[model samples]
Target: MSEIRKIIEDLRKNKAGMRGILAIIIIFAYGILGSYFIMGLNINNSIYYTVITVATVGYGDIIPVTPLQKLFSTSLALTGLGLLAYIFTIIINSFEENLHDIRSGRHMEKRLAEMENHYILCGFGRVGTAVYEELMKRNQKVIIIEKNDEKLEDIEEDDNVIALHANATEDKTLKKLNIDKSLGVIVTTGSDVDNLFIVLTTRELYEDAWIISRASKKESIKRLKNAGANKVISPEVSGGNDIYFAAVQPNLVHITQNHGIDFLEREFEILKKHNCHLENIEYHFPGIRTPVTRTIGVLDEEEKDHFIDMVKNNPEVKESLDVMYNSVNGVHSHWISGPDKTHVDMAIEELKKEGNLLGINLDFKEINEFTKQFKE
Candidate 1:
């Protein structure tokens, strides 16, 4: 029973490819051999007759004359008809299954395309699954790209979570997933080689995307990092460290288990605060061409010169404190403080009056609201 179940499962996953091959072989062998011996016909004539007979397209040009020949013809007709029925059943089932897969794949593709500022997880193993769970717990949108379809079969269905059965190393797959628009990618396949390939491919597709890769071997860590992975982790190393910590520092392990699990959750709040600061500025100053304003990090070099200078000189304008600069692409984005919204506004207005030197544009988050709007 177990063996039968295993075979059925394999067939279900493989789309009857092996069964189709075996059927073709049986049909050709039986057709040629049966017709040649029973009809006493030449190879070419026997094959032609077999084709017509099996397809139920019998032409009157070939007819069985002897008793034995007629008996064989009747037997062959029964066998052919039975085979045809079986073939039709398989074909129809295959057609329906293919149609289902087409629809499912298209839905996955559309979901992946619609994802923006999301993370692409390129594996479904233990480490990858852990990361996925943590991200989901934080309400982060995640699209999983795993080559193994069986691994994806039981995934929990959610709008923010999608599983794509595709090779991450393929450029077409990454492009179809809109890797360039993603915030980052995580490669956690068990193989260091596969992770390295995925990192390289993802980096090629999206230079700005943050990529984290898993390395199995100690020596492969540097290689993975050099291959464009922003962070490279060896599961073996982490696992060993975890075991050591659990043995020697049980209290620390408990603290980590209790607290570190929610680290990503806190990141969600931090991201929300940052976005609220930017949106507050945009909302308050509508006539300032708010769409043409940009945000920069507090630690940016440009901020040290322009933003810091203005914020330092004018203590009255303290509502917004982020600098607005135009990038080569005519758009730039950064973070600001909520209290400094007015300062940034006045600075932008002053710059505009001085003659539009910075050709900028607009940009603009919640927890449940944030997840619904931004998550995947």
Candidate 2:
């Protein structure tokens, strides 16, 4: 609605063009009335003369005879011709501009339809832009939904980014982006309310999508989570934490600042590079309650047999180990478990050294719960 109003106001504010158009209208009226009064022509004949004169198509059938009529005819012909040219120029330019907009719109729509496993970013403010840059660094596909045209302009030349100038809070916009086919959504609008709304709408459209939202206030964090965000981040909180970490945990801060691994995100990228899809891999990040366990990939018949033979002779590995299979991809995967974090680290380190020799990956973290289940 605001966009339509802005366009209308812009058209109304084109004083130069409007003045020229008004002059053209008045000149045509004068040509018709002057001919009717001075040349003794009827209304229809006067209008006919006016059209031909303005069009610069003098047929010689309506030559001005009287002195007053000839002067009036000369004035009308010159002024009307120039005005008509100006008007036609404006019309042609306007037509070309509209055509370009239409072509770009259709192209964007086609790109949106073809996008799969892309991330939808709602907002292009500071927070959003930072997120976008990080994702771009990792060569991730991202679609930006922003209401401000200026923000979209910043990414106009970026081929990897598809920006839509629309309200992200609207479900229709989310649907147009194909939320179900997207990998996740990030809402970083300036307003917490708007971010919450975007999160809710995205969640309603895609239940399994990983939604990360930015919150301005502490209270908004829980609200955003309730609205279906998988992760809620506050820049202020993160900044304060970084300051504190720098003072107390200097070494840890240095390692985090210089060599942040982001194990889960890296694992996904590695799997993607191997032609393995996210849906085919099951992952769980280690937390206080949840153990860090990730099922890296699936193997075919030959790869599975070779993997088993390589690890079967190892004394550290279980004799009758469990193998997981992804029915969707028709591939098998070997599972490893550890009793604790130290044991898990040792197992992963040892297996990683031979993972290449076995023609399979064995670098995944062990889930304590999975280990208990496996033993039973």
- Indicate which candidate wins on lDDT: 2
Question: How close to the true structure is residue 177 of candidate 2, measured as C-alpha lDDT?
Answer: 89
**What TM-score does prediction 2 earn?**
0.59
**What is the TM-score of candidate 1?**
0.54
What is the clash count of model 2? 0
Model 2 misses residue 213 by how many Å? 1.2
How well is each residue in 1-376 modelled by candidate 1, as lDDT tens digits? 6644654554556655466557657876777787788788899998898788777788979999999888877766777787778766765676676678779888877777788756778888887777776555335567888999998988886877888888887888888877676656778888888888888887877787777777889999999889897777677767422221121111111000011111323422443443322221121221223334333222323533454456556654322332221111112222222212333344334334544222233222111222222222
TM-score of each: 0.54, 0.59
Please report, in order, the local distance difference test score of every candidate based on alpha carbons.
0.58, 0.60
Residue 56, model 1: lDDT of 76
lDDT of candidate 2 over 180-251, digit per residue (tens): 766667788889989988888788878877787888898999999899987788877663222211211111
